[model samples]
Target: MPRENSFSDSEGRSLTPDPEDEIHYEEPAAEAASPTYSIRTPWSPTGHTVPHPFSASRRSLHSRAPHPIPGWQNLTPKEKFRITVRRVMAMHRGASILTTGGRVGAEPGVDPRRASADALYSHISQDCVIEVVDYSAVRSSFGRMTNKEFVNFMGDKSASQREPWVKVRWINIGGMSWDVIKAVSIKYNLHPLALEDVFHGHKQNRSKADYYSRHLFLRILCHELGDPDYSPSGHSAAQGSTLTGEPRSMSPEPMRDEDRLNGVKGGDVDEEKTMYGTPPTSRQSTTKRRRNPLLPTNRRDVDGMPKASNSASNLARLLKREGDVKDARKERQVEEVSIEALKQGERVNVKVSPMFLFLFRDGTVISIHPEPDLDFTVPITQRLRSRDTVLRTSADPSLLVHALLDLIVDRSLQVIDEYHTKINKFERRILLKPKMRTVRELHILSGDLILHKRTLEPIKTLIYGLRRYDVDRCAALIDMSDPANANTKVVGFMSHKSKIYLADVFDHMEYILTSLDMFTSISENLIDYTFNLASYEMNEVMRRLTLATIIFLPLTLLTGYFGMNFEAMWSVQNNSDWLFWKIAIPLMIFIIPVFMYSDLTRVFHFIQKKMVTKQAVKQYKRA
Candidate 1:
C-alpha cells in the first residue's frame, strides 16, 4: 500500500516519488557552472578545418544580414522624429529636461533669465526640442518662473549644454481635466481659453493661436469618460414623490375618518375623569390638543386626539381633508425624489477621442496633419492596436504653443467637409422624391443644411493662413532649388503631389459650396411656392364664398318679401282665386319669352358676325 500525497505533476498526475529517487536529486554547486562568453570569429581560416571553396574565404566572407529596422524610410519626417524621440527618451531612466516653445528667442537686452529656454535653444541649434521637463519641482517652482526667465533658462549656454531630443508622447488618457489644464498652463504660459478647452476636453482636429500672440488654442476631440455600453431607462418617473406621505423608512399611517370623528369615544374617559377627580377643564384639554385650522370640524387634533363630528356633513368633510393630505404628501415625496435625481444626473462624464480642431498660433496658421494620420503608432504596439489612430493635432502641446491662428481655418475645412458629406447624402435622398411640397419639405431639409455655416468663415480665415504658410515654404524651397540636381527632381515631384492633394481638397470644397447654394435656392423657391399656394387657396375659398352669397341673395330677398304681411294685396276688392293665377301666369310668360328671344337672337348675330370677320380679316391680311 502506497501513501497518498496532495502534490501533482505538471500533467496533473499525482506524484509519489520514492524516497530513494528523491535522495538522488541534489542541488548543483554554483562554482561548477561554466562562464558564458561572446564568440569572436577568426579573420583567417584555421589549418585544422578544411575550408570549402563553395564557402567564401573567412577573411572575405559576406552574407546577407537582416536589414536594420528600416529607419525613416517608410516614415514621414515628422513621424521619424517622433519615433526617434520616443526611442531616445525610453533609454533614459533618471529625470530628464525638456524645453518647449518657439524656434526663436527674444531680442537681445531682454533679460536672459526671462526668455524661453526652448526657443533660445532651438535658435542656437536650429532643431526642435520635444524633451520632458522636470516635473518634480513643477508644482512649487512654476509660479516663480516668468515667461522670459523660463526662456532664458532654456537658452543655449554652450555646445556641452545642448540636450538630445526627448520624446513627448501624446497620452489619450481620461482627458486633461481643469486641474491638468491649469497645471499645464502654469508650466507653459498657455492661454486661458486653450487651458479651458483642454480642461473641458473639447478636442477638434486643428489648433489655434490667441490674439496678438503665439499662444495656441487647440481643440482635441477626446473620448468621454465612462462605459460606452450604457442604456437609459425609457420610463422617466414623473417629477414628484411617491404616493405615501410617510418617510421612506416608516410605514404609512392608515387614514381613519370614523375614528377621528368619534372623539375618543368608548375609551377610558372614566379613568381620565378619576385622574382629574372632576372632569378636566375644557381649556386644559384644548391646550393639549389644538386643532389644525385647515382640518374639518370632525378631524383629529394636534396630539392625535379625535374630535366629535356633529353631522354626516362634518364626517364627509373630514374624510375629504384626509384624502387631500394623503395626496399632498405623495406629491411632495415625488417632487423631492425627482429633484434629487436630476441634480445627481446633471453633470455627465462623456468619453471622447480626438477629432478635428481650429488651432491658433500668431497671425499665421496652417493645417497640421490636415487629414488624420490613420496609421500613427505608439511604442506599445498592443495598446496602439486597440486605440484609434487619428490623434487631433491639437493634442500636440508643441504645435499648440508654436502654431499660429490658421489652425481654426484648417478645422473649419474639416467641419465643412463633414457638413457637406452629411448634406449631400440628405439632399440625394430628398431629391429622390418628385413633386415634393417645397416649403415644409425644404424646411425639414434645411435642419442639417446650415449646421456648420457659422464655422465656415473662421475656417476660411485659417485656410488663408495655411495658404500663406504654404507659399512661404514653397518660396523657400524654390530658393534652395538647384535645377541641375537630382534632388530637385524629387522636391519638384513632392511639390507637384502636394499641389494635387490641395487641388483635390479645394475641388471637393467647391463642390460642397455649390451644392449648398443650389439646395438653399431650391429651398427658398419651395418656401415661396408653398406660401403662394396657400394664398391662392385662400383666394379661391373667398371667391367661392362671394359667388355663393351672390347666387342666394335674390332667393333670400324673395323669401323676405313673401314673409311680410301681403294681406292688403290679397284682400283687393272682388279678388277671385283665378286673379292670383292670372297675374303670376302672365308675368312668367312675358319674362320667359323675352329671355328666350334675347338669347336666340344674340347667338345667331354673334355667329354671323364671327364668320364675316374671319373672312374679311383673312382677305385683308392677304391683300
Candidate 2:
C-alpha cells in the first residue's frame, strides 16, 4: 500500500509489477522443427474431421516440393502411388528392394540406391525338385531328395568317407525357388552377383559364363517349338519337308546297310510278303490283328533302351549285349549327326525356357532349371544309368553338361526348321493372294524371328566362352590333377576332355547362330515383300479404275448434254438425225482412240515390270 511511484519491497521498491517480472511464453522445440502445411479448406464445427497424413494440403505441399527419393522425384501422382506400393512390397519378409543404377556393394540395411547391382529376390514359392546322381567308375546311386536331404548330403563329410571312390556328383535342381537357391548359395559360397544373375527372370538376360574362385557359372536359354499337325508316332515329318535345300524320297522298302553290303541297290523284299512265308493281310485284317491281345508286343527301341529277351535266365546277357550295341551305335551316330544332312519342312511351335549350370573343377555340376516342363536332362540321366554308355565310362559330370547343351542346340535347330517351313508357306500364300491380313501375319513372323535371334545370340556367346576356356588365355582356370590331391588341384578350371567337347558344342552353336541370322534376314525381306505386293496390287486396282473412267467419261458427258431439257442446252434435242450423226459418231471416235492411247497402253505392263524388278532385288538381297 505505498505510493505508486515510490513504493519498494523492504528496501523502497515499487509495489506495481515490473516489465521484467511478466511471463513470456515459448514455442515447443518439436512444433518449431516440424514441417507446416497451409490449410486448404476451413474447418466446420458440424463436420467431423480427422487428421490424415495424405490430406489435400499435405499432398499439395509434397507435389510442389522436391522429394528425397532419386527416382521418385519426378514421378507423377499415379507413379508415386505405384512406387509406394512397390516400397511396401519390398518391406515385406524375404523380399529385397532394388534401386535404379545401384552400385556393387549393397547390404541389407543400407540405402538401396547406394547398394550393389544385384537382382532383388523374394522367397515366396518353394515348389522345386532336387535330384542327385553320385557316381564313380564302378558304382552309382540316383535319387530325388528334399531340400533338407540335399543340404545334409552336400554338407556331410561322412558321405565321401563312406563312398571313398566317388569321383563325380551331379545335382539337378528343377524350378528355381528362392529357399533352395538361398540354401545352395550359402552351402557353395556362391558369388552374390552370380546368384543375382541366376534369379533374374528376364528373356533378355545374356548367356554368361563367370569363372569364380571355386566354380564356373553358365546360363543358357532353352527354346522348343510345338506343332500339332506332326504326329510323334507317325512317319518322320522332317523327312517330308525340304526347306533347307534337302531332298526327300519315299520308297515302299527301306534299304538296310546289310543289303548295301550284299551289292543290292534296290530292295529285294516285296511289301506284300513276310520273311517266314506268311501271307500279307488286307487293311481291315491288319487293323484287327493289331487289336488282338494274342499278338506279342513287338516293341522296337525308339530311345535305344535295353531290350529284354522272353527268357528270364538270359535276360541279363541279352540286355548287356543289346546295351553294348546300342552304345556303339549311339557313339557312331553322335559322330555322324553333325555331318548328316537334315531334311527340312518341319513344323514346330516354340516353348522357350532357361538352364543355369554351375560346374566345379572337382567334377560336380549343379543344374538349375527355371522351367520345370523342359526336361532335356532325361537323356543324360538315362545315359548315366547305362553301364556301357560313354557317360559312365568317362565318369565326368561335365559330359552331362555338354550333352544337355547339345540337346538344346539340336532342339533349336529343329525349331528353326519349322520356321523355315512356315516362311515357305507364307511366301506361297502371299504370292497367290495378297491381303492386309497376310501382311500383318508376315510382320508377326518377323517379330518372332527377331525375338529368337536375340535369345540365341547370348547362348552363342556362352558357347564361345566355353570353347575359349582351354586356350592360353584361360589355362589358369584348368585343373589336371586328381581332386583328392588338393596340392595339385586347381580351383576354377575345367577338365581337358570337357574343353575339347565344348569346342565341338561351340561349332554347333555357331551353325545355329548363322542359320538364325539367315532366317532373320529372310523374315525381314518377306515382310517387305508382302507389303510391296499389297501396294502393287493396290496400284493395279487404281490403274484399272482410271482406265474404266477414261473409257466412259466422254459417253457420260454426251448423255448428260442431251438429257437436259433446257431449250438452248442442245439443238439436237428434237432432231433425231442430227443427234445420231453428230453425237454418236464423234463419241465412238473419241472412245476408240482413248482406249488405244500410248499412256494407257503401257501402264499395266510398266507397273508389272517395276514391281517384278523390285521383288528381284529384294530376293537377291535376301539370298
Candidate 3:
C-alpha cells in the first residue's frame, strides 16, 4: 500500500483545507463511527467546526496522535494553544459524560438544536435543586433557584454585576444533571479539572485543595459514619492579585460577561439586622466548637476541685454579685447540651459523598453536594438567615468554608461516636457471654472505623493547606489600609478572622482522627477478647466432660461385670437387685471420691460464691 500525497476525506473532498474551503465538517477517523454527525464537532486543529456537547473521542492524551490537519505546522503558537485548551476541555467533558451517562443525548422526537441546547448543561440531575445565598455584614439573602432558570439566571442571556456589598454568593446544587454542571461551569468558569473532581472523583476518598488561576478548587469526602482510597493530585498556580496581595479567583478560564452577574435572587429579601449585634445562642455557639467548656477548667477552687473560677474579680461585684457561679454553670449546661447533640443523634445509614467547594476571590462559593436531592448544608442556610451569627457579618468566603468543614467534622464526630457506642456494647457482650453474632458485628464495625479513618485522614492536608498560605505559594497578604488589621495575616483561602475558624476545623480533624484511632484499638482488643473468651469457655466445657467420663467409668465397669456370666450367676440373679446396690454403692463412693473429689469441692465453692454476692459490677457508663 503506497501513501497518498496528503490526508483526504474518505469522501470526495480532500482532508487538506483547500484555499477555497479553509474549514471542513468531515469527521476524523475517531468520530466517523458515531452516527451523530450533524451535531458532532469536526476534528480541526484550527477548531473551525461547531462545538459538540463534549470532545471528539475518549482517547488518552498520551496516546499516539491521529493525523494532524494539513498546514498545522505553519500555524502560530496562539492558535495552537487555543486548539490545545479546547482539546483538553473536550477530553474531560467527554470522559465525564461517558462515566456519568448524563442526559446529554438528543431526545428521540425533539429538534436536535433544542436537544443540544438542553444537553449543553445537562449534567444536573432530575432531582437537582439549586440554592443560592448572598450575604454581607448588614443583611443576607438565601433562597432556591429553579433548575429551568439556568439560561436566564447564569447564561449569556443575563448580563449584570453582582452587588459589591453582597460579600459572598454561595450557589449550591444538591443534584447533578450534566446540564447544570456545564451551565454552572460556564457561569463560574470552573476549572475543567475541578469539575472532573467534583463530579467524577467520588472514588477519591482523600481531601485536596488545588489553587488554579482564578479560584480555589477544594474537594473533600464526607461520610455518614468512609472509602479511604485517595490519590492526591495537587497543584498551586501562582496567581497575581491587586495591591496588598489579595488572592484572585483561580477559575480555569475567564468567565463570560453574563456569568459575572451570578448572585442570589432579590425576591422577598428579608433583610435582617435582627439583633445582629448579639452573639450566637449557646447551642449554635457550641456547635462546631472543638473545645468543651464543660470539661474541668484550669482554675482550682478552695475545695481543690477544678472549677470554672477560683475567685471572682472585684469588677464582678459591680457587674452583679461576687463569686457568681450561675453564669459559669449556665455555660457548662449549654456546653453539655451541645456536646451531647454532637455525640447522640438519630442513626444515619452509612454513606460517603464527595463535597466540592469552589471559592472565588469575590467571595463567591459554589458547592456541589454528592447526593443531588439531600441538602446537608441546611444548617448553614438557617444560620445565614439568622442575623445573630458572626458568619452573617463576614465578607470572606473562607469563613463560609470553615463553617462548612466544621459542620462536616462535627457530623463525622457524631457518626464516629455511634460506632464507639456500638463497639462498647459488643465489648460488654463479649465480656459477659461472647456470641458469634456479636463478633461478626464487631468485625463489621472495625471495618467501618478503618474506612472512616481513611476517608477523614486527607482532611488534615486540606486544613493545613488553608491555614498555611501554601495553596497559592504566596506569603500572607496584608492590607495596611485597615489600620487595625494592618498587622493581621491572611493566609491562603483563610482571612485573618476566619483563621480562628480554620484552627477550630483543624482541631476537630485531630479529634476525629484520635477518636477513630481509639475506637479502632478498642475494636481490635474486643475481637481478641472475644476469641480468648471463646477458647476459655470451650476448654472449660471439654474439661467437665472428661472428668465426668473418668468418674463414671468405675460404675459402668460394675454394671458390665454383673451382666457377664459367672459360676454363681443364677443364684445372684435371683437375689441380684439388693446385692447389686450394696456392691455398686461402695465402689461408686470410693471411685467418685478418689477420682472427682476436687471437682466436687470446686463446684460447691462456685455455688457458695454465687450465694453471697460481694458487690455489684461497677458500670462506668452514661446514666
lDDT of candidates 1 onward, in order? 0.31, 0.52, 0.55
Candidate 2 per-residue lDDT over residues 1-623, each given as its tens digit: 32322213333432222323312212333322111101122122224222211111111112433234433445457645644553332222111111111112222121111101111222122456788788877888998876445544543435523366677788788766543565565456566556655644353456677777677778787776644543221123453211111111210111123422232236342223322232322111100000001111123221223454322223334445546855986897576453322312232346666678887767778888864322667877887888887678888867777877887888888877887887788778767876666566666666667777888887777776666643443445545465754454333355568677878777877887787777768767767877787788799999889778876777778777777778664466547756645876778777867676887568778999999999999999999
Lowest summed lDDT across 10 adjacent residues in model 3 is found at 283-292
lDDT of 2 at 615: 100
Q: TM-score of the candidate numbered 2?
A: 0.54
Q: After superposition, which runs of candidate 1 have C-alpha atoms over 4 Å from their true positions?
A: 1-174, 179-451, 469-500, 517-521, 570-623
TM-score of each: 0.31, 0.54, 0.53
**Cα lDDT of model 3 by residue, 575-598, tens digit:** 847777787788877877777778
Q: Count the backbone clashes (under 3 Å) in each candidate.
A: 56, 13, 23
